[model samples]
Target: MQLDPALPALNQTVLISGPGPFVLLGVPGLVALHAWLSVPVFLLYMAALAGNALLLGRAAADKALRAPMYQLLGLLVATDLVLATSTVPKALAVLWSLSGEISFEACLAQLFVAHVAFIAESSALLAMAVDHYVAILPASALQGTPDRYSVVGIVAVAAVTHGACVMATPVALLQRLPYCGQQALPHTYCEHMGVARLACGDMRPNIWYGLATTLLSPVLT
Candidate 1:
């Protein structure tokens, strides 16, 4: 494939091993503004962490909040915490200290956790919507009463299974490709496509799978 004239030429000589560390070029155009951007990003991270922590605490402490709906909300909050923690600290490091280096394994792990949390969160939200819908159902119109706990359990299992299976495909695909040329990724976090695009070998499978997951995840949820 021909190199883009608009972009810097890949360093053909310096090939990175599969498990080697990558340089994260966080938002290339905003390099000069990284320091300025770190402030708000830090605040947002703190807010998300604090808010989720409080919600989780409330759910755990209050007996009244032990209902199926609140259980799902707890799952959502937990996933939110996971999602934020998986990427935010690294992002803050990059923005504040320009410490953008990340190991290949670490990158893939981050990608998996972040995406899984996102999918799981969506699933929880959908489950909550279903719960709301069920709340207004007429008693006479219903068949034998559905077990609320069973519904919550099913939703939780489905969310985790879907997230694990869907997100794993791209990680597996990426692992097969040989990474040559530039190791610098132009993102704050280790996104599947962003990392895949840096690989030296054919990454069409990764691209297509990533696109498929991105488009289908919402509809599937």
Candidate 2:
């Protein structure tokens, strides 16, 4: 799609298409309350990003928090901030922008970051499972919910244990894909393996890893 500068470039118009059905039905209600609602959305989003970022910051501040697992969970939460902030607004824009198109390089960038967040969340969930067994198993084998406070205490602990291992593999694999298909993605959300599925070359590794992660998530939990 190389263009010659010899001729005038095509002029394009961009508009907001908004959303369909559910959105159409919902947005007007949202807009009516937009002033109030927007404040909450913004504040809540900032809080999530801020809180997670703080955990990461605290992890760096004290040597005691430098344990391998805490460090890993801190990394995961730090990344969650990046995902919540960097990707969500652009995604909303992509849905609204009339062009509804993204550059291939941009798409790949989104794929990498978005998948990392997903993996971190998955790893976090798994860590929850490990904590679940330890914290839920009562001292007398008949204790109630109060006995599970230890699991709640160790949420960060478990997240890091699994996150370290999970983060390592994907960080390597994501940067290596060569995109050779049509530049368009059918859906707006940037999904790593789905995009990889459209790749012209074999994606056996991606498919295998995806299945393995899915199975391991539930099994390990």
> Each candidate's lDDT (Cα)?
0.86, 0.54
Per-residue CA lDDT of candidate 1, range 43-147, in tens?
Answer: 999999999999989889999999998999998998899999999999999988658999999999999999999999999999999998887888775678678
Clashing pairs in 1: none
Candidate 2 minimal-lDDT segment of 10 residues: 16-25
What local lDDT score does residue 178 receive in model 1, on the 0 to 100 scale?
86
Winning model by TM-score: 1
Q: Which digits, one per residue and each the tens of the lDDT, describe model 2 over residues 1-221?
A: 44455654332111212111111111332434534544555667778977887888888899898654574466467657766865665544443442445554565566566665665666665654554565456578645644334443465545445545654564345446544433444454556564665455567777778678768865765
Instruction: Report the poorest 10 consecutive residues by lDDT, candidate 1.
Output: 8-17
